[model samples]
Target: MIELGVLFGLLAAAVLALIFVLLRRGNGSTENADGLLVEQARRLQAHNDRVSYNAASVRSSSPTTTDHYRP
Candidate 1:
């Protein structure tokens, strides 16, 4: 019974150690992180551009309060 408990503790410790080692190995370089930032900036700029275009289209096609209430 004592040996079984010791074995289970060692197994849990080894699994935790393996997880820590893998996470440490996955720490990437500055270049990869910078590339991610640049990609996000590009996506944001494209979204802004699309929103601007749609806003202009809606402004042109939709009527104003004055137009709606005009005699």
Candidate 2:
């Protein structure tokens, strides 16, 4: 009877350890995904800013039809 009790205790401890490790791994993966998304968003915003700046510069430097249509 004493041997049976020791076996059950060991089994329970092993199962608990496995569950803890799996849960920790699942959380780590979620954090990694979140970090990747944040990095991508930062890069997208930088690209958009550059494009907007270029467009504004082009508009300011180009001549308009109004310049030639005045009486």
Q: Which candidate is the best by lDDT?
A: 1
Global CA lDDT of candidate 2, please?
0.78
Q: How do all models score by TM-score?
A: 0.38, 0.38
Q: What value does the lDDT take at residue 47 in candidate 2? A: 94
User: Where is model 1 more than 4 Å wrong at Cα?
Assistant: 27-71
Task: Give me candidate 2's TM-score against the actual structure.
Answer: 0.38
Per-residue lDDT over 30-53 for candidate 1, one digit per residue giving the tens place of the 0 to 100 score: 655878899899999999888777
Tell me how many residue pairs clash in candidate 2: 0
lDDT of 2 by residue, 1-71 (tens): 99999999999999999999998877444535878899899999999888777744756644433454458
lDDT, candidates in the order shown:
0.80, 0.78
Task: Report the Cα lDDT for residue 19, model 2.
Answer: 97
Could you tell me the TM-score of candidate 1? Answer: 0.38
Query: Which clashing pairs does model 2 show?
Result: none
Candidate 1 yields a Cα-based lDDT of: 0.80
